[model samples]
Target chain A: MSVQSKPRVRVPATAAKGELIEIKTLISHEMESGQRKDSAGKAIPRKIINKFTAAFDGKVVFEADWQPAISVNPYQSFFYKAQKSGAFTFKWKDDDGSEYTAESKLTVT
Target chain B: MPNWFGIRTATATRRQALTAGAAGALAVLLPRMVLADEAAVADALKKLYGGKAMAEGRIKLDVPPIAENGLVVPIGVEVESPMTEADYVKAVHVFADGNPLPGVVSYRFTPDCGKAAAATRMRLAQTQNVVCVAEMSNGTLFTAKSNVKVTIGGCGG
Candidate 1:
């Protein structure tokens, strides 16, 4: 079943050239590990965001491999140096072959 | 009167002795369990870095000293780097000593990323150390660690 997923991204609106800046991201997901049993004792199928990636200016800046142990509503923050004005694309890959994406722009002075 | 079979007397004393012995064993084993978790962390590190020595600096690991819930412990890691094409952080790995799986997550970064830092939420099995190792493009490894006391277990406890 397709679920509604939302991704949030935060990036500095502006930064000095060559200055290090932080980027934070959070995504809403159930992150079910399939280990839980339903009220009727049926096993719940595992559905989690297994991979995440961040790309800037067509180059991959960061990537993460996630497991079922990641908590619900996964939050991730990372840093990148400001080289020039560009857009960062964040993508999350779910186990069910669904992908959620978000974007943030950074302007360097 | 003495019983014909010695089984009656042996059973009575043996049962009592076994109970005492079991209790004593448990008392000794409980503390060792914590140490075993540390060994697990060490083993995971060895598997990842092999014989390469990791310098313990340049990386900042932010984790709460006391986590109210183990299910969702916030973690942040950042490494000092120029982020230039010549010298940048290539990857970062996070580990939990008390979890069933020692390796929690691994992040890779390119020079275009500009900085070497990541924050995420992790599920800790119990009170344990959260360790981070950052790999630089120059083949240098930096390490940092923080202890988190988890009140409630997060790994399906």
Candidate 2:
């Protein structure tokens, strides 16, 4: 039931105006699917991260749709061409209707 | 030894009846099972790609055709776009047709991104089709798919 995102993300401090750079993100979550059974044989209520998004300087850079099948502590990596230097924000939404967010700075040279 | 004829006649009749029933049932149910998997995959693809209706071949899904691990498989997606204010790739959606839940991930991008690509490790339950869908700047959608044969079962199979 707890949702948290990484405090920082590392992208190259500088890149050619249109150079592609690797971006990595991680979130802290249990990602429980309510379908499983507990010790007492009762169905464990599903708690899963349903969505994720990354934005740079107010523009959307990446987004993801998550399902109960995804494992705990989701990890994702992707690439984006650096056109400017600014802050990238990561956000995640869980099935329990909770939201968690994190941000990192990008320096495009 | 003395009742050989009676035994032969009874056995022959029983075998004939069993064969006739099995043939009839097979004729009725064989196609359904054979086509069920394809139908399920198709249904999922439609849901993922048809949202915007205009599918442009802009999505690239990169994964090994044979994954040794079911617990963790690496998946990478990239779309052809300029990532600029005037136009950019908006979102990317991924699907594993045979996975318990076919929809795996969705990524949204904006103009400042400069480039558009995502890599992540995912779980695969079995050998199945993996699909990628991308939404473009003007609300257009594009899709691509590939079938992967999993050597080791990931989902307790």
Best by TM-score: 1
lDDT of 2 by residue, B28-117 (tens): 854432211446656765775543465657777898899888667888888888777878888877777776566677777766556778
DockQ of each: 0.53, 0.42
Q: Which candidate is the best by DockQ?
A: 1
Q: C-alpha displacement of B22 in model 2, angstroms?
A: 26
Poorest lDDT segment (10 consecutive residues) of candidate 2 chain B: B29-38
Error of 2 at A66 (Å): 1.6
| Deviation in Å, model 2, residue B82 alpha carbon | 3.2
Candidate 1 residue pairs in backbone clash: A80-B113, A80-B115, A81-B114, A81-B115
Instruction: Report residue B35 deviation for candidate 1 (angstroms).
Output: 13
Instruction: Return the top candidate by lDDT.
Output: 1
- TM-score against native, each model: 0.78, 0.70
Badly placed stretches (over 4 Å) of model 2 are A1-8, A16-18, A38-42, B1-38, B44-57, B85-87, B138-140
Each prediction's fraction of true contacts recovered: 0.76, 0.64
